[model samples]
Target: MTAPFIPVNTPLLDGNEADYLAECIRTGWISSEGPFIERFEQAMAATAGRRHGIAVTNGSVALDIAVHALGLDEGSEVIIPTFTIISCAAALVRAGLVPVGVDCDAATWNMTAEGVEAAITPRTRAIMLVHIYGLPVDLDPILALARKHDLKVIEDAAEMHGQTYRGAPCGGFGDVSTFSFYPNKHVTTGEGGMILTDDDALADRLQGYRNLCFQPQQRFVHEELGWNARMTNLQAALGVAQVERLPRTVEIKRRIGRLYDEHLAGLNRIRRPVARTGYADNIYWVYGVVLNDEVPFDAKEAMRRLGEKGIGTRPFFWCMHEQPVLRRMGLMRDESHPNAEYIARRGFYLPSGLALTDDEIARSAAALKEILA
Candidate 1:
């Protein structure tokens, strides 16, 4: 008989998730305001090595809040990776800032400092560095560039919980950093996010933006508009539990990556995810594989075949330059991001969730070997 179908990602909820959630339910503190919300915020801020963490509704809104907190002018430009999710670009656009696109490094599948430097113009107000998949970007050079250019650094370390760059943590380096606690993330809150920063003023601004710009002195009088992107106490309950197990969660993800590495080593037609080097290792956010030129088909075809074999897979992010919405907005027209486009076409990640078992990983690897062969 065939084995049960494996999923792309699943949360590991064997911690204090239930107890804390029950506490919230029992206390009738299910809304955004509660003890767990503050506890989760504090834990996440400490985890990221920041002074303050303002919890938000989701990762996308976290980006929006971070962008707005930068206090850039309406037409200011922010450099971002072309290979990342649309939320990064949309956040800048929604904040009335232009998003300048840069291609990813062919090997690391991350935006390089060189690409970021090359994309800088006078209007460039900040560099929004996204730590893609679980590997932190080479941030020293980017930080240096920002210093020389007087640009703000927004670290979107959503995919890199517990992942470090050099000796320091990923989220600790930037002017402000953002994290997502989505179910697929290492530390999950079902649907929540946080903005981290050491700056006292920026943290205050973030708190204001999270709750519809409610004036402290007067309850409902608002001078500026803000979003109701507050993360609920119930979600924070899960977040608190997840944060307590972050180290173990990261280890499990790395172990999953290693398992796939061992099982898929002989497949010469596909390139496996990068391992740890002088920089941080691929925490294997997902065990992404890139099909070589010798492969007969692209990632879409490979995903279809893997699905047929009861193996779940997800395609890599499409390049922002080719996005229809951006095109309609007269942005990314006739632009070519070769590396981003190539990776988007060839890359896909397998079932690398924290909850995936050794047997599931082996079976998924076996299916890949058969399909690729």
Candidate 2:
């Protein structure tokens, strides 16, 4: 019999997930309103070291809420990493804000403060920073620049849950931060996300935006148009269960990362994820592998071969500046981010999900080496 295929990402749901779901069904509180929603929001706020957490349907929507809540001018520019998900840029664009893409560092695969500094303009309103894969963007210098320029920092900590930078929480730094509880994330809410903030007024606005801007003074009245991106009680129930087991989950991810490091140490054809940086250790959100020039093929070919061996893989995010949509819209028309462009073509991640086993990890690494050889 053929062996099973190890998926690129799978969540570990061995917690109170079933119990929470049972409670939700028994109580008939499965909509956006329920005790679990508040509980999950509060728990996540505490986890992220923020005063308030606004639950939403997904991370992309959370970004949309965050960007609009800032109340930036229509054409204000926000700097973001070029090598990041389209959702990041889309949030700004849809909010009538301009997104300026910056190149990330080759080693950490995270944006540097210097690149952000150079991208700052008089019309720059905020630094919408994202923590890439597992490692965090160097935040201190960026925070300093934000302070100097009196700009807001919108932290996209979707990939940095249970992570910190220089002993501070990843989601706690910026004026506002967002987290995604996708099945692939450390905290899986079965399609949920949150916006975190210490500012009471901002939190209020965020809540309003996520829920159709309902006015508290009157029922079924809306002074402003907003998204109906509220998270269901069922999703929040899962989030509450997952947040309770986060520390254990983080440790599991770290162990998997270390094992991959040991097993693939001598594979010169592929570059491993950065183990640690000056301020923090990589949480290995995904054990990304970059094919060097000697590999003789791009990530697509490598992933195809790995798939044939029943080892799943995923490619890195494409550079936003090179996106056809952005160029077609006449935004960043002729820009290039060299480092991100190079990795976007060659980098891909292995099976690093919480459901992965030791044997699977070893087999995946062995398959990769065999293909390279």
Candidate 3:
């Protein structure tokens, strides 16, 4: 009999999650606003060491609001990594701004200060940093560069809930940070996102935008044009439950990731994920291993072999510079970023869900060893 497939990503749910849903039903305030939503936002803000969090419908909307909250004029350019989800670039475009795609650091698979410095022009308005794969991107250098250029920093902390660098929290490092509570994230709220910041003025602007640009004191009075991107009370109920269990869930993910690290660290054909000197915390959303170029087969074939063993695996995001949408929009070109392209082709993720059992991990490891051998 064939072994059951090990999925690349999965959500771990529990009775606590159900309890939140039941409470929401009992309260009968399942739509736009409720006590659970307020409580969830409060809990999340406390977790991130922030003063406030504005819940949104999804991550893309969170990014969109972050872009607009900065109050940039049309045609201002926002610098973003070429290896990020397309939403990062599209959000800037939606705000009537230009996106300047920068190359990634091969080590972290995230935007480098060098790339940002090289890409900046007089029109540059902000630096949007993405903490890819739950690994905190080195923020000091990026922040310094932003200071020198007088640009703002908006962090996409979607994949990095509770991740830390040198004892500092991920969301607190950026001027304003956004998070996603998609099912596949470290925590789940079915589908939701949040914007957090210590800046009360910025937080207030974001909250206003989230609720159809109406003043909190006056109902049905519009001051600025905004979209309806509010998170439901039902989703917030789930979020509150997940937030309570997040510390344990993150611990499990880290333990499983360390197991992968211990097993794969010494392999000649595999390049394990590297942590810089000061980054102390990571949840390892997906255990990424780069296949050394000297390896006999490329990433695609490696994935195929893993799949044949009943292991579900997939390739990483293709570099945004090479994506057809950005190219068609007349933004990127061939000579833009070779590092992003190389990492895109070489990196692939393995099964790294929090729910994977020790037996399943051992089985997956044995399959990988056999294939790589």
TM-score versus the correct structure, for each prediction: 0.98, 0.99, 0.94
Give lDDT: candidate 3, residue 125. 90
Please provide, for model 3 over 181-215, each residue's C-alpha lDDT reduced to its tens digit, 9 standing for 90 to 100. Answer: 88778877889999999999999899989988987
RMSD of 1: 0.9
TM-score result, candidate 3: 0.94
- Going through the candidates in the order shown, the clash numbers are 1, 0, 0
* Top model number, lDDT: 2
Better structure of 1 and 2 per lDDT: 2
Q: Write the residue-wise lDDT of candidate 1 on 1-373 in tens digits.
A: 9889999998899999999999999999999988998999999888878999999999999999989888899999899999999999999989888888999988788999999989999889999999888678888899999999999999999898888888677778788999988889998888989999999999999999999999989969998899999999999999999989989998899889888999988899998877975787778788899999999999999999999999899999999889999989987676689999998999999998888999999999998889888
Better of 1 and 3 by lDDT: 1
Q: Name the weakest run of 10 consecutive residues (lDDT summed) in model 1.
A: 276-285
Q: What ranges in model 1 sit over 4 Å off?
A: none
| Cα lDDT, all candidates | 0.90, 0.93, 0.84
